[model samples]
Target: MIEALAGPQAGGVDDLTASDLLALARDRKAAEDRAAADLLVVAARWADLHPPESIHDAAAFAVPGCEHEEPIAGQGAPLVAEFCLAELGAVLGVSTTAAKKLVGHALELRHRLPRLWGQVQAGRVPAWRARSVAEVTIHTSPTLTVEAAAFVDAQVAAVAGRVGPAQLDRLVAETIKRFHLADVDPTQDPEDGYLHVDPRHATIHSDDVHYAGTMRLEAELDIADALDLDRALAHGAETLKALGSDASLGVRRSAALGDLARTQTALDLHTQGATGIRDADGLPAAREVVLHAHFDATLDGLTTVFGPTGRMEEGQRLVLLDQLRSWCGDSRTRVTIKPVIDLNADLSTPAYEVPDRIREQVILRDRTCVFPWCTRPARGCDIDHVDEYDHHADAEGRPQPGPTRTSNLAALCRFHHRLKTHTAWRYQMTEPGTFEWTSPHGHHYRRDRHGTTAVDQAEPPCPPDIPRPRRP
Candidate 1:
């Protein structure tokens, strides 16, 4: 079933019909995606093909029986970049500059927006979309500070696929306007007195060479003036909403600004709601979205996403959490700790069923398929009984089930679980948050909540006489 764990004939899934594949894909995607990302990274590291070091002299570098045994260039990251550009240019038939730009875009995303890069490796975000975000964000405000630029890029990457191209551009513009304003930076020199001319947008012009509505409106208003204009427009839109108007927010706000140009209006939530133009309490609170946190994975000071979803290395997850906290606010954000599986606790009464509480604990502990090096998030995996279950009839003809307790459970994404069932490889919960696995080659592995380590001891047995399953 290594083939099922991977390969074109994976888990025999490649042979499945479209309908069957669809259902299976949902369960297998996390494992498959993580596997794919790992494989791609591995492939990139391998020198068998497309080695960047070979790019300087494509015909000579690393080639067998080549006269030039010496290297073409000194080895370092810059050389890597140069070779990448040259190689890409050759393969794609583009100039080195264009290839450099392409490589730069990829490197920027990988370096700055790790979550987005992971999604790219997971095949969730396409190349075009990632490139689009990187390019337009750069174009929108070329002078943005480093902190501002990274914040905006990461924000755009987070909400990448939820919006369209035009909307993405608009969002980029909004983010730039919010973070790249004339006074957004606080450390600017007060001695360098430069005049900031107010937005000269009393004039609106459409395509100068055509009749299209597409136009550019340049602005340089004072920060307060810009904020005031936004508020007035929002207030006007709210007032119109209170009056039962069915205009879009953009349209209503634009009209509100025009009304403000003629007659000043105010943002008064209480007044608008009293007039029945808006909800008396303003808009309803945003609904909650589940963000699985692995407290165990939260070693030191970083929190990790539960599955193959998104992640950052070292303190990056901390940065992301701070950003999310800014968005979710203090009161709305909450945390729940999933204790390590006790190997002896039963939280439910259902026969052969892992109750939600116990299942959550195992998922938090395992964080992925318990197989060695598998990074599939536990949420997308099956809760397998480390000890094989035996079903039988008890006295008086009633059904008795195998123990469905925490100590007996481990999270194994479907493929690994099936692999265990179908082959000589076997694993058992040797202790709390620990699994000892024996591979087909008799190699022993210890996978715990932390990570995998090679072991010299044989696989241990699960605690015997696990309480019989609860009565039917």
Candidate 2:
């Protein structure tokens, strides 16, 4: 294989034999797998930088500007992992779910299975095979875990690249048995265990012109419980067939299952003033998402960002609003009408405090920290004043306060908040929806509700480095 990798650049491929082609394909895949391993390691390392600062338990203090550096390892690790998942999804053009799986691989590779990580890095093991082994081995660790590693390493050294994913899994399972962890204890009481239903996989299969979404579910249940669910679905399917539904058997069965599931829980839904307002767990439940529709009839322009996804098509926004309004009375859903923003919304009285409603509007508009590339959800941020508040000098030489309104308010996560407060990152709101920030080097940037789109448009989060922005 090494010879095949060298053979391509060392000679011409035009004269290669069939065996040579096979070797080249295998070698190329090995190289690519190693590159993937390298990328995962780097991402894991980058996530380590902003170690989560623990706000609870025993506390330690860091000076205002350096709070990010003093957190213990694993402090704030979840947030960093979340950030990695979001940005990695964007970069890979994959969904957040897939990105999270990638992060799982990254963290496990870097921390739990360094020896296997090194094997992948050296191109001695296929990436999928290594990951399969890691997943099976992850929880089998104790002081006994070190022995498991050496045993697995010896097996791999004997037959490394020849193993497939299934073979690797079997090897790991067999090795784990030496430590008595290959199978569950049959003597344990079944009633003590809890059932779980999980979405095991959701995959997208597509060509340039067509696509399909496929999902598989994983569930654990007792034999009697499984038989009861099967009987219920069978009865529902028979009833649907008797009703003369035209769907195929498979489609009819699926519909029957959905109907049965909905019927089982549909009684819990309530109107705004309904007597019962609890979920299955008996907790109060109310719809919290507010859909915003921004339309200007005079200009014939309209748009709305929907669903917490922060992704909305401006062209269809008004149409979606109309459809939603039409469905309000016809469906079980409850809808409310509320104004999310105000034009002359200056709050001059409190001078620095933002009311809850206005803060909510700002958060919805921003969706995240106004700083570039920072995906910290705005709900947890400090609503910073774009223009710092201070006592104003009036025409009569009397003191006046600055206005605290939506125009001057923007969300900044804790780290960026301190950076802005203590550093030379000067900002001003030149217009209602735009923030103009100037670096110490006199570079200029514009941050609107949308994002960075002009000169000195901020660098990636954490660095606060000034990047020369380009105009669109």
- Residue-level lDDT of model 1, residues 1-472, one tens digit each, is 3224443544475667787666666657656656644543442332223334443334433433221222111111122323223323323334434554565455445544456667767678765566666555444433444455566556766775455765665555555555545444356443322222222344544223111112344565767878987887888899989999898998788667655543233334344653433323353223344554323234354333522222322111222444433334534344454455553454544367777888877766666677765556788889988876655544446543446777778888765665565445678888877888775445677788676776764345333334212212
User: Model 2, residue 145: what's the lDDT?
Assistant: 57
Please give the clash total of every predicted structure, in order: 8, 2
Candidate 2: C-alpha RMSD after superposition: 10.0
Candidate 1: list runs displaced more than 4 Å. Answer: 1-288, 294-350, 393-402, 456-472
Against the reference, the lDDT scores of all candidates come to 0.53, 0.54
Say which candidate scores most in TM-score.
Answer: 2
Q: List the residue pairs that clash in candidate 1.
A: 4-10, 4-11, 199-219, 199-220, 199-221, 242-277, 307-377, 343-407
The residue-by-residue lDDT of candidate 2 on 1-472, one tens digit each, is 3354455466567677898788877777777887777777765665564345422111444434532432111111234423334334434444444555665665555454566667777777777766665554443332225566556656765666356555565566556556564444567554322111121232322112111111234464567877897787788888888998777777676666656544455344542334655556543444443444443434344343531112222211223444444346433345565554554465434545788887877776666665544556677889887766765445557653445777778888876676566445567777765667654334456667666644643353433344323111
